[model samples]
Target: MTPSLSRMIAQAAGRLTFPVKWFTYGRRFRYEQPQKGRGREFFQWDIDILGTDSFAADAEIISIAASFYKKLGLTPQEVKIKINDRKFLQEKLSAMGIDPDLTLPLIKVIDKRSKVTPDNFNTMLTDAGLGTEKVSSLLNILDDKDGYKNSEWLTGILNIIKQYGFDDYVEFDPGIVRGLDYYTRTVFEGWDVKGEFRSIWGGGRYDNLTQDVGASQTIPGVGFAMGDMVMEEVLKKCGKFPALTVNKTRVLVTVFSPELFDKSIELSNILRRENTLTELYPDPRTKLERQLKYAARKGIPYVAIIGPEEMEKGLVTLKNMSNGEQKMLQKEQVVKQLI
Candidate 1:
């Protein structure tokens, strides 16, 4: 992560965002099946805003996440971005008289809260050295209804999110302590409304991560990562995924015979020169029916056939694969129609 982040910073990106494939070994055997959203291999879309510590930066990150959901045609009712701050959590714990040394371990337990049963989660918390009273207090903090209401950092970011018209998609949830220790503040995760799937993505502010990676300068950054597997699943379930279509070769030039192959090639080139995506049938010996079938299979909408007679007439036969409509047109007209 540091290597990629460093490269983005070096490239002068004010905010870096991209999808990356990641691999991890689940050596601890936390769960049996690596199905649904959790797996050893996955693709994550990461968004990071570096070199700023302002609350506006945090708001911008959240807004970007909201924009992504909007682009996917997901409404606020379909998805929610839960946010919390590590600094706030630490302050709460310190006020509760919990040892700072035990905070990280407790956070790990909190991260697994949804994965384990309540009894098992409590046992894990106790095993991590929290007494019964402290456990109760911690649970209260985690479950507080107005946890972020009084938090200046959170409210500031929330106000900015409202300005960006994404407040409906976001909310303050104190339970959102990202599992990673590198995160210093503003942790968040995207969740399905029904809670039927694992988190779509999770990330937060990691102010000191760059310094930990041996960078001489400190780069305060906030970001999130969404795995492709979970996102794809959610989009399909919501019927938001668009119909897949062929993006290349909008027009296919069919070779009628060996003798007129050059005419087909020239037609394809001319169409290509006019900014049209054209594919030429490789073998002139292939039957015209076979070429048309290939174009249909590839979802190429238009096919241009330059046969012996059509070549002699300085015209090409254009077939619309969808409607089976055919017309004889001059080369310029064919190009115009295809483009």
Candidate 2:
């Protein structure tokens, strides 16, 4: 099993809590190369707050995930956070007289429901040592729309999430029994609304993880991790990918000719001093047309050309590559105009 981050926190005198890294490897045969979301090796963004067992901690964690979606420009209509409590699921199972040992195996099967056919899923449950009668009851509970409607834990945490104004991005989901024995309460998964992609991310409260690993005491925690692959696909589908640009070059200083190369270099240095992102052409002998084309190709929005004619007047020709507009500006005015 992967070592518990919670245990590490307790040993370190509560030094680290939020934004931990959990590096893990998955089987290549199952997680094939170049797939939309699956891969052989990946890192998970595991955010957690230790030393508190309050449902408020769970609410705060969920709010952080909703805030992240907002940052990515994903509307509630485009994605949602599905929430459930493992304790609630265990309660329902106990009510149906399910053997405690079979709970983990049963959850693992339910976790694969969307991937397998209904018949195969039922067969897997039977193979995992569940009798036909218990399997029927379990399936009914899993299918019940109102299964979690009466859960006080779910109700309380959701009310807190509403106060954070993230209710639109979340809903009660009994089927989300995160496939892990460590998670004791408040499990969740972020899903794409269109259902065309896999889960954007998922996590839950693992109150026992610290003690399970080796700690003498438990630390309650909650967080989620999103993979870059699925997030990129979702952004592309929603047309929310930000416009790409060369980060260091908002303006390109083109070497108009060998004779005027020094002027271009000087102007670039001035722009840099003014806190502008500037790139200077390295080759003085490069053609003006070729240099301008290079600037445009690099997504540089503006270009400064210091040819002999402009140099004599101590002026520079500023061109807006996006609109193909050019104007003559005094050397002193270049900084103000470009800025």
lDDT of each: 0.83, 0.81
lDDT tens readout by residue for model 1, 199-236: 78888888787667666666677777676778888888
| TM of each candidate vs. truth | 0.86, 0.79
In candidate 2 the C-alpha lDDT for residue 324 amounts to 96
Instruction: Write candidate 2's Cα lDDT for 291-330 as tens digits.
Output: 8889877788899988878988889999999999999998
In TM-score terms, candidate 2 sits at: 0.79
Could you tell me which residue pairs clash in candidate 1? none
